[model samples]
Target: MKADTVGQEAADGLLPVLRELCRGAGADGSLPLTPRALHAAREAWGAAALLRLSGIARVLGEVRLSRRAVFHYSNPDCPCCRHKLTPNERAFLSLVRAGIAGQKTAATGAALILTEGGPVEPARNAALALRGVWSAGPV
Candidate 1:
């Protein structure tokens, strides 16, 4: 993940938290965060936890959030290459379009998707720094 996307601090802290969550994942080996669950988690565990979960969600390719302040693209095709978008690219483009049209409910939500990934494989870490941040009210 690019540090610039979600700020250096959040980028640094996010991976370790995701690693911890991966270790404790359910039998399905998937970590899913519904919008409702994400909001509830924020209320119970503070906004930091929501940020962490959003980071993981972004990695899982479950959410796409535009970092740009303004929408630019019109065609789903590659602007420079002028080629048809791949399926993944099309999905991302659709999400961005939905976001622009204010049709995606997730756009109103607080989860700030930091990076893009298809299937993320988190590295295991011995220590988790985010444990405290989860219940610490706010950062």
Candidate 2:
């Protein structure tokens, strides 16, 4: 079978398993898989392929994307310190808040980036800053 076909098959097969894993983890109060965890999952699933193709990795990519969306929707602030938030966290929060405010995610992301003091080299920093501003409130 072609690599793409194999990958699609693998991903389709793995989706239910992955979802079950996530649901079980959530039930146990464990956080969803981190990037590293997702990578590991991809590797484990891809092991079946004699020659791993990029398509085979899409299963993990979808997991990561779903996780990101969940994280963004949750708008989790730093538990230890509210002032501090990760870039991904910020991006997610921006998406959620903007959605709540009836704004589009793309526009919100762009506006957040533009509001930064200058060019945002490490994109994450700009994202975090935008989240801070969007979430900031009266002291």
**CA lDDT of every candidate:** 0.33, 0.33
Compute the lDDT of residue 29 as modeled in candidate 1.
40
For residues 19-128, could you state the per-residue lDDT of candidate 2 as single tens digits?
A: 33333344333544445435534564445322221221222233233332332111112343322333433343343334334455453463344334333223333232
Give candidate 1's whole-model lDDT.
0.33
Which residue pairs does candidate 1 place in steric collision? none
Q: Candidate 2: where is the Cα deviation over 4 Å?
A: 1-83, 105-139
Tens digits of per-residue lDDT for model 1, 1-139: 1111112322233323333333343444455665544544455445465765654444333332222221121231235422222233233323333333334343322123322332212210101222333333432
- Supply every candidate's count of residue pairs whose N, Cα or C atoms clash at under 3 angstroms: 0, 1
Give lDDT: candidate 2, residue 5. 15
Q: Which ten residues in a row have the lowest lDDT in candidate 1?
A: 118-127
